[model samples]
Target: MRPVLLLLLGAHLAYAGKHSLKYIFTAVSGDIDFPEFTSVGLLDDGQFDYFDSNTMKAVPKTEWIRQNEGADYWTRATQNLIGTHQTFKVSIQTVKERFNHSTGVHTWQLMYGCELDDDGSTRGYHQYGYDGSDFVSLDKSSLTWTAANPQAVITKHKWEATTYAVKEKAYLENTCIEWLKKYVDYGKDTLERKVSPQVSLLQKSSSSPVTCHATGFYPSGVKISWQKNRHDHDEDVDLGETLLNEDGTFQKTSTLGVRPEEWKNNQFSCVVEHQGKTIRKTADDIITNFESVPIGIIVGAVAAVILLLVIGVAGYLVYQRKKGFKPVSGSDDGSNSSAHT
Candidate 1:
């Protein structure tokens, strides 16, 4: 039974890397108001998962296809992905999808990756192309598509001997452009319906850097940053990529580092700027150790002591000022005070 289980597990792993799908839509100008993409993965159990590019969330397959008219066009395209000579089996298993609305002109280009596995191992392979276009016979191996590389020397015949071929070429290109217009209009019509994400801050330890996170937002344009001190200035902060949430919303994290070991003494903050809303977080928002209630209580007490110390220092500064005492900047104590995104 143990041997059988291990064999089953091994088989499962090999089958897991089988197939996936993806889509990307971009509007340079006058095509779509915004740009977005979608990715899909095939599961071993024959289930399909869909993800929105902006939110990085796993959307239900039904909802994705229902809203996007381009899906039907792409679906048919996916069914026909082929590469030149089929050397790359992984190409068919993967999808290189693009919907370009460049320079106010939209075009559709897609490729299906193909790959092969030998006892659960794979060698890198290439991809091929196909759509529902009537010109499939002209480029059966997707050789014509290879010219995507700017410097590629490969070129295919543009002029056909017969007038029927000329008409067909025009039709295929026109159809893609028409589809591009439809896709863009659909995006613009639904653009305003997206929701804004909620922003929050979290920390692993009291002294650790704070991570400002935003969740459940749409359209993926939220900017997160860290600022130091109480000034209206921006500071350098480590920014993470915007990712998709499972609910079709967007989320991202921006981490702000502490100043030496006196992070508490130095005022630090995180600001999430999204859709005209400026949400902020400070070191004061920490929840302390969460391992256990006893630990939490202990941490609270420690925090209280730290707070009292800060208050005492502030009071001393006020008293010193009243007595006309000023410390030289370069001659000050080892404590250096400063303040991000």
Candidate 2:
């Protein structure tokens, strides 16, 4: 399992033709048993660098990055992260005071990055959050900051009075985008590689919903749907978000809720599409982990699955804050204003 602290920081999803690079800095205050300060850098939603107050050193998370960057790069990144760590520590206290939070698990985070589309267009963003809520963000075009809450208004005015927005805009539009492109080139083979997903059909019991799970996929572009009698079926379907695996692959699940009688009366199947290939599985392929288990043990098994799903959802929520890029056909310009837990 990934460190809970890292999950609290961010796990960002990747977008399909467009590539992105993001930096996430987190500071915490209270009795929470976690690193007080930590920094993470992601390339196309895959972590490339990470640093925490405990190690006090910046390290690469990918072999390609470690091989391409030298000692000087790590040293410079470490120094910059150390400075940001201290700044975040102070910022956390400032936010606690502003929110009247005296002693609890409070977090202050800053996320900023740039996105490059395959067509050569780019977009940039800089956002801050306090205790899992939006604080403020920079509007590059206007050279101003937008405050999400009243408490952020003070910081907004403070930044607008100085040349902070100008500097940030310059970095996001130029330096950040340049770095993103360079990093993408460094790992072109890995980042651009395509891998098909392994599909599975699962069910806890006959009464439980059937889950279609797909794992070991790359580029994070996949579609899982249900079919009834060779036609598309959408009713009573629960689609899950694509999640990152520790090995740099992705996984997703979609559950179909239908009575056993209804499923028996019709030919139901799960279909997964990725990388120009399709895989289909029918009810006959369902894997029941609870088979032959006692009633009490079966209940426990169900509870365990639910718990895991809850934890996955928590991580998904954290990752959702750092917006990803999109393909050329996508209309979203990789801009999001709100930051939620």
Candidate 3:
């Protein structure tokens, strides 16, 4: 089916390193003075280096460029890029028809190399784009765009972009990914290796969702979910994004909705699956383990009581021994103590 088209594209493929592509579209309406425009790019590091589009060159000349740390790199990248400019003139008669001047710009970027472990496999890729100031994200199976502007304006020519993107993506996978593998063997700076994730539960709040959070994870492939009676439950669960932590680890949160009855009945648990093992923690566990300190205090009190009784018994035995002494005065005969004195 059309569900996944690229996976079926090739039987044998070559490799290539650091190859990519991009595109842009602009449309204007309303004022008699209006125009239509669009563009495409092949980029490095998210910036259009060694190349210039009409918008790229003009936007950065002002504060936007100077404030950008990568200004120098992209501006200089033109030397390595191929660029072209076209001018179209409309006679005075056609000017009245174009008005309102709606402009849209979209760009896509990609970077691919061989997996560090396997030459035949790809290290995967980093591919994303921008629709004007908003963001667009894509993967092997999906393409998405988000913006504050109305969806209508954004989707105006979405089909055109989609068709081009699909073709370009297939081109990269079948041609670019493997071709790069020839020259670009993943030695060190390749894809990140997988690491076992740390899993924890967030505190429960009244009327709020119960969250199971995993932090300091790796590979972005771990799973977190809810369980009832040791059984996994997926219904009514929401998974948040897996974001990178400051320490280069990944973190994500999954929320489970519970009815008032479930909380009162203690019917929920958080379970995390990482590295082929499952760790489960339940709300009832908190209540069962929270009083360990109190158990230690009771043991201490019994020890103190036993020590007091032993001391009292020792004191009584000493008094009895003293009372029995009767101070013998003479060496042998049963002489009176008064005579010896």
Predicted model with the maximum lDDT: 2
lDDT of 3 by residue, 1-341 (tens): 00111111123323322222221222222232222222212111111111223343422222222343354544443322212112111211122222223343212111121122222333222222122222222244453322223432333245236554454445435544343332122211222335665555554445556667666555456778888776778889998755434333456678877775776675688887876867776665422222442443234334433422221222212221322110000011111111000
Question: Which of 1 and 2 is ahead in TM-score?
Answer: 2
Model 3, runs deviating above 4 Å: 1-175, 178-184, 187-192, 245-248, 284-341
Tell me which of candidates 2 and 3 scores higher on lDDT: 2
lDDT value, residue 323 of candidate 3: 25
- Ten consecutive residues with minimal summed lDDT in candidate 1? 332-341
Tens digits of per-residue lDDT for model 1, 183-223: 22333333334576665566677667667767666666787
lDDT of each: 0.34, 0.67, 0.35
Q: Candidate 2 on 1-341: residue-level lDDT in tens?
A: 01111011111223235777776667768886667876667777666777788889888878889889898888877776677667777777887888899986777767677776655566777777776567787787899988989998989988788777887676666566656656766788799788888777888887899999887788788999999999999999999867656566677889999999988899999999998999999988887774643443334335434422322222225545434411110001111211221
Cα lDDT, model 1, residue 279: 81
lDDT of 2: 0.67
Ranking by TM-score: 2, 1, 3
Clashes of 1: 29
Give model 1's TM-score versus the native structure: 0.43
TM-score of each: 0.43, 0.80, 0.40
Misplaced by over 4 Å in model 2 are: 1-17, 290-341
Candidate that would win on TM-score: 2
* Superposed Cα deviation of residue 51, candidate 1 (Å): 11
